[model samples]
Target: MGAKTALLAFTDGDLRPRLLRPVRTNPAELVRVLHPGYEVTPIEDDDLGENTYPPYDTSYVAVLEGAELFCDRRLVFDPPSRLPARVLEAAAGRRVIMHGMHSVSDWLGFAVWENGDLVRSLSLSPDGGGGDNIGTPYEFELPFWAGERPVKAPYPLPFHPLVLGQAALRAFFGFVNEGRPSPDDINPFEVALHGFRVADPTGREQAEREAALQEFLRKVGPPRQYKV
Candidate 1:
């Protein structure tokens, strides 16, 4: 079974704590309003087929290995583990929505944001038992941090439930648990969220989206222009 998750990033530039609202648009309505298309998976394995959701036309890429999708909005995912790279990259430098379903081999998480600020980031993976990450602000590292992302042990591993300093814990996860760490504070490279369960729908399509958005912006300067 595949892991189903949708991470949405917005460009509104607010990072506050707010729950992701559910998708109000109906699937049948989506099919009627937009044309459907196909997108290939980012996995190295060629055996996997294409992803048929999002109608393939509403996808957007924020950066390399990062997907910034607004089409998903607040759609609910069942056991979400796989998310396109474009969506993950979108989470940084903007307001975003990330949700993951439980899976043994994949990272499962639920993180909510208010505007562009973080609120709660919880890891639902059972891999490390109860010691696994339950709450964190995992969304902060999505921006293009300047450094070589390590792929081995000892070095920082992305989304590995970083070691929170006793003093800093109150600000991060909102609570400090004993037996964790009390000395030095450190971070983990959550680049793996960008690497794993990712897909590449199309670079050309994303470019087109950016162009379309630009054109729309040019026509209407901002939301105030459309106010009645």
Candidate 2:
């Protein structure tokens, strides 16, 4: 349950099939497509087999057989419907899938779009309750929404958001980050990705962002422990 992801994909169709066969691509070119005017410097080769989540000011990108994926924590939005227009434009007329989860906060947000139209988008956590729920529930989400999977007693939400979070990963992306892998599951390790140092031209944006995070952490202090 400690696993985390910040993944976005643009695919012609099902990404799973395209992921099965790894394809080499120009990481720089892919980054330009997704990032546009951002300053990008090649850093190293990364893989989706692990570490799909990139750190602040970094991104892991890949142009697969028929899919393109970018991993960066900054992609996780409170309500996935607010995904930047530029990013969505990269997949105009194709299917776009976004999967974001933070195990520390037990938060999950995901969305899917086809042919420039949103089909489903959701964000929820026990602490924050539901954020945005648009469109009808997909088939894979039925069981959780139907109360078939209930959280243990003393929990606020009916189901663990992370549990359903993992389910959404497998359903939308054909893999699970924190659960037992199925034989048919895509071996994320086999998927090749390239890493890059992405930053604003002046470096001021990243500096200010880090400063804000530090201030927030200082105010929050140390983590508190609780017992059942």
Candidate 3:
């Protein structure tokens, strides 16, 4: 389970059907709309699979007929309930969906907003249990929360977070990051996305962000040495 994603979408209604259409898109304009005030330089074109978990300093964006998607690891907010105000503003009056997963930590999170109102948000991991869970469980989430799909013994959570993560990915985005492709699943490869190198205009913000990350890493220190 090496899959990972940091995806955000804003659409009029169902995104899956919109993605199926072959509509021309303006990726640069889409990036600008979502990342106002940031310096965005068009870099390359990439398919969904390759950009789902794009680099922290880069973003992959696309504007469909009535839908738009932006993928960047920076958008993977912990306790997704606290999505940045700017992002929420961009999603105003539109149905917004966000999904984040890190296979290394077996963590999964997802959030949904309808017309600027939060409908559901959840984030969880084995090591930390539920990080942030709000609103009622969606139909697709019921089975896992009910213990119907239990995790292996010796695990803390009722189910493997990543398993639920995959389910969430399919449920919200009409695709999966792993597993065999199903006939009904959306062919993300068919959807083209534009990549951009995003940076702050002043360079101060980027430096501060890097300094914070370094400080955090310093506190966490190196991995523990153990004999197997």
Candidate number of the best TM-score: 2
Off by over 4 Å in 2: 222-228
Best by lDDT: 3
What digit string (tens of lDDT, one per residue) describes model 3 on residues 185-209? Answer: 9888888887899877988878998
- Residue pairs in steric clash, candidate 3? none
lDDT of 2 by residue, 105-170 (tens): 888899998888889999998889999899999888999999999987778888888899988888
Superposed on all Cα atoms, model 2 deviates from the true structure by an RMSD in Å of 2.7
lDDT of each: 0.33, 0.84, 0.84
lDDT of 2: 0.84
Instruction: State the lDDT of candidate 1 residue by residue for 114-202, as single tens digits.
Output: 44355554543335322223234343433212233332464233433222222223233222332453343222111111111222346
Stretches > 4 Å off in candidate 1:
11-95, 102-107, 130-228
Alpha carbon lDDT at 225, candidate 2: 100
lDDT of 1: 0.33
lDDT of 3: 0.84
